[model samples]
Target: MANDGLSAGAAARRLGVAVTTLRTWHQRYGLGPSRHEPGHHRRYTVEDMVRLQVMQRLTAQGVSPAEAAAWARRAPSDASLSGGSPDASGGSPELTAADLAGFPSAAPHPGASGRSGVSSDVAGGSADPVDSVPAARVGDGEGGAPADLAGGAPADLAGATPAGLVGSAPAGGGQTIPLGPRANPAARGLARAAMRLDGPSMRYIIEAAVTGRGVILAWIHVIMPVLIGIGERYEATARFIEVEHLLSRTVTEVLAAVPRPPRDREPRTLLAAADEEQHTLPLEALAAALAEQGVPTRLLGARVPSQALLDAVNRTGPVVVVLWSQLPGSGSIDQLERIQAVPHPPLILAAAGPGWPVEGLPPTVTTLGDLASAVRLIARATSD
Candidate 1:
């Protein structure tokens, strides 16, 4: 923060990112520091810091790194330092709709859900219902397209819906995943990128949400909505399976990228999907969330056989084990029973996801209703 500038470490700390990330930005995107001395390493000048902040904010909001760098490089030298702009609050200017004119606005499809409420199952508690807003009519002048996201929709995806549906809506008319009326801008941006099959953009938006809002908030507010919206789209149309798969893959990658506790720290918590359940995004979210709290966990992803799970618990001696099942067919009570009957049973045995039956759970088995509760319960159990 000196008049001269800040070192790479100091700047990374200020931006809440790793020094290597700064290095990457500098090396790949040309957003490096300019201040140099005859006998010292370069430091990030105030202007450079402003540029970096812009880059960080945009990327966090789901803008691709390349595009974000372009905008950051164009930021005014004193945009954040000098008190001269119209809204001179001593920070970067808020990017307006006009500024993001290049990105396509996600138009609402006729068949998309109009409600803007979060489901209780996904929200991790009682559903918070907002008054339903009718689905915006696309192609009509009243609602030409949804509001523009920070990272504009990619060009090819502007009017293209997924291929091979029975009766596909016209291009540019119903190409979007219906996120309801009040979806988060980041969620909308992510959906746009997913529909475009733009992996880099999807990763950028997800990583940004996870970085800026923590695993829990990011999952609840941003990632879950898109996932649900896409699921609904698939249910209604029985199409866009490709979009779902790519988005799921991108989410998995981003969540896996979250840093874990030190190698020396032993993992005491174990997470696994039920015997035939393949839906592990929730579990992945849980793992990342636990990692954020400095907890290490063993995640046996997707369709973990009961014996394999029991063997894992017996070998690792985990204090907490959470089993997830996404559908009734996959929620086998025998899996939970067998784990509980292990010679040295885990201290906390939890059944998560909607698959588990409501009535006949074992006395010792705890139910994890949502991501927030799972993180808190498992983190506490492990810490104990």
Candidate 2:
């Protein structure tokens, strides 16, 4: 086909790379379609852009330009890029534990199974595996709570479990709603309480919980905010350990029941950490949502070294890296700057909680307090 279509600049923009780099790939690697234009300026076709995009993903995955070019040469046809491949182009179908970085599971799409490695249950093995919410309303931990909320004490959920509901709705209930923003006051309260938590303590609760929708929401909204409030209260004046302990134990149970989402196409490799000089709860909430959205995620937890983060990015090539700081210190700012310098940086750098003193963080760097905001951000990015 003739290549007298898209301009070099447009093609570069679509490929998320510079025009010069595209030109270099075209020249040195024999990539790109034949370029031609009535005005004699190079014009790349949609095919050229598609090839470039495939090359970009391959290169991001650590493939060399030459090897990426070779792979792109055999990539999907141009037709596949136009509203095809499940949730837009170049999106992964399977989200790993690492992809669960900033939001609930993304909506399902036909192409969600495009890539491999996602568990068979998530891929399409059996919808029943995902339908396993307990029949009884599990305690929110406001009353006489047990020690093992999600740590495999059968007694906790045993009463709620029914033999017939194993692969579908509970005996008397309906279908499970996808984990998302709920207008329920309970969800809002959870979000509010979590906003007060620092990240580390919050993460301890989430990572330790079982995977289910209810558990996921409680962790994102309730436990997270409560912890933040406790941290703030501690900063102001000493507080009783009983209050913190109650909050932690209660929230930990909620997270243990939330199930990871089926499959999503968002990039895997999620990163969350307490900012160099900050707390970690906001990041923990973000990570939980990411898991629900089906993005594979990994939380480095509190006090990660800037060098360690950079190395992780280079080694893992995660699609997004989230940095949460309830209180941003000079060290946090310095580390943030260093991360921004990494090549082809993660899709987002987010902060939440408090004390972000920087004047102008990048547009992609966002600060959020609740699960709703994180869900929307990841959902939009995944669809795009």
**lDDT per model vs. reference:** 0.61, 0.40
Stretches of candidate 1 exceeding 4 Å from the true structure: 1-174
Clashing pairs in 1: 103-152, 159-172
Q: Which stretches of candidate 2 lie over 4 Å from their true place?
A: 1-221, 224-237, 249-253, 261-269, 274-278
Task: Give the per-residue lDDT of model 1 (tens digit) for 1-384.
Answer: 798899999998886666866887898789998999989999999889888877765544434456667777876563443222222223233323322222222322222221111222223321111223222122111112233211121111111122221123222324445455554556655665655455676787778677776777676556655655554455455555566677777878988999999999999999898887766766777889899999999999888998899899999999999887766688889999999888999999887765678789888888765567777777778886
Clashes of 1: 2
Please name the candidate that would achieve the greatest lDDT relative to the true structure.
Answer: 1
TM-score of predicted structure 2 = 0.40
Predicted candidate 2 versus true structure: per-residue lDDT over 286-341, tens digit per residue: 55556666654666766677788888877777665666443335225666667778
